[model samples]
Target: MVRVPGAKVALSTASCYPETCTTAFEMAADLGFDGVEVMVWTDPVSQDPDALRALSDRFAMPILAIHAPCLLLTQRVWTTDPWTKLQRAREAAEKLAAPTVVVHPPFRWQREYAREFVTGLARMQDESGVVFAVENMFPWRARGREVAAYLPHWDLLELDVPATTLDLSHTAVSGSDALAVCDALGDRLAHVHLADGAGSNKDEHLVPGRGSQPCAEVLERLAARGYAGCVVLEINTRRAVNRDEREADLAEGLAFARFNLAAEAAT
Candidate 1:
């Protein structure tokens, strides 16, 4: 099998949702992932750096990245203040020796935070020495009308951010060409959330190659370009009936990533 040396396939802790953060590390270790991206949400274990480090040590799984608690359900995770949440995320990443932090654009309702998000992120990156990769989000749709939910638009192309995280599922939701966006991001693409969607309004974090998105193509392209970033599996397994089912899905996703990420060896 061909292998990409620098590209590491990681599992997002959120992928184990309905399962505890601790379970994610266990599963990642059991399944042989390169590392994991911790999604810091309401889970007490997720928010504690010491606890996370302990799990990492126990599993011998390095923390690849930290996904800031920016989802609606996690608004009060670190605090009500959006900036504070990012700050804490960066601190946790630094403490864990993770190289990147994934953050979503502020919601339109968070007026003050949205207003200064671009500049604020730049400042944070400069001061913290961590890559704050702004994750792409999609516009909200309701009753056949498109609603502008995220500030400065949900499309990363419209934003003037230095670093970006290309999430394939979000690209499907936005009807964006994943490859084209990747071409545009170029060296600015710092991380990847590898999942698929079928151009649905709902973000269906389907397994790679399971939906309509070019999941395999993206992995291949990253391999061809010698990408040295984390391709994180962030699929939804909450529907899984048991740990066995979830493990099966995770295993399939990991295999898909590994197979596609490998380029033909030089003859």
Candidate 2:
């Protein structure tokens, strides 16, 4: 496990119920999170920098990162043009004072976008102060048939991306070792989506330590290596019975991060 002393532990806004984006900021602040990653999607406020900045001020939690509206559900957030969406996300990041923007690779069908992804990403990073951290996505499998869902696959070591958002749940679905993947990432690792999965093809965003991923060790490793990136708890609590259950799950994930972080310091 890597020890990242003084690193901020943030909560991805998408980790909470999709009712309202501000709900996430409120919960995160109440739970003692140092910052938050705003996942921009259909929520009107998420697309508005002013609104987000207001919430950040109200909660006193900084917007650590901005997740671009790249998922299928968010296809209509900014614009149909993938490049435009990225640009909008970058603009939002700059407005919110977020340092990183998390994005998913293009789908296989978007041949044109995929073709220019690497080069375009480079240009964006060169043009902006923010880092475009491409996130790892799992493959789609059905009836023993596997489909290459993402342009760069779930592992990003080969991509010429300057930075990456290492998602533990995606690695679990990809059947990749967390430590090995982190090792390969090295300096390119700019952010982390802290979650867990049961090594199933399903993208189960389980709480840290609830699945097969070495969640604690990974945290410790980050601490030990003096990682400066923000650690965002991106777990799924949609299956929770109620608000209390969701709060409990999120609390547990935060506690896990804190404990491992402290343990690393001790060692």
Candidate 3:
């Protein structure tokens, strides 16, 4: 088995692909993340899936996954039409052949909508033969760990293996138990979104080590448990002065995160 504590650092192509996927792959390759998890928004980048695939492969990144398009304004998941975002997501996955799709649960939808959404997601996962890793959102929260506090039901919903991505910082923001969340999750975790929060409270995606979280403790827990999954660094994009600045900051920040992971392993 692969080593624990020190995982192959991963990059979310969303960090690089805000405009085009080629740039995402190129930057990821040049910057040295072990692999990439991409977001296929309805923009021009996802419009051409094959190209994205070719680029990712060319970079020789071992793992490839996609984040399903989640429209924040309307919060639509799928439909029958051509512009049907979910349909396009599946098409993009098939064409680019990503292993999984990361999904975000709607925060304030009617209970019925969440049900239909989960059912629909399950069907899509079956048909596409791709893993659907659902992420937790506050059904109602000041932050992410609140989702963990309400976790037993959501855990059942995501019992399927490899269909859950643990966003530690988000959960921390929810004032949830990081170790408890990790414990309950076990092997179902396929990915992790990393950032630091001001304690177990605020949902700020501060650069790792720049906040109050016990990063070393969390890493130690994962190391001891032998959890092998992607750790995605999610610094807020809004603060980036420009694309180039974003790229530079993200590259440096991810490198630091990975280095700490190595340090965790050694300790």
Each candidate's root-mean-square deviation in Å?
1.2, 1.9, 4.8
Cα shift from native, residue 140, model 2 (Å): 1.2
How many residue pairs clash in model 3? Answer: 3
After best superposition, candidate 2 residue 237: deviation in angstroms? 0.9
Q: How does each model score on TM-score?
A: 0.97, 0.95, 0.74
State which candidate has the highest lDDT: 1
Query: Candidate 3: misplaced stretches above 4 Å?
Result: 1-7, 17-20, 57-63, 71-87, 117-128, 139-162, 199-203, 242-244, 262-267
For residues 12-83, write the lDDT of model 3, one tens digit per residue: 766653546666667777888777777655555544676666677798874456777663532443442212
Off by over 4 Å in 1: 1-3, 265-267
Off by over 4 Å in 2: 1-4, 262-267
Highest TM-score model number: 1
Worst 10 contiguous positions by lDDT, candidate 1: 1-10
Q: Could you tell which candidate, 1 or 2, scores higher by TM-score?
A: 1
Candidate 2 vs. true structure, TM-score: 0.95
The better-scoring model by TM-score among 2 and 3 is 2
Clashes in model 3: which pairs? 143-174, 144-174, 145-174
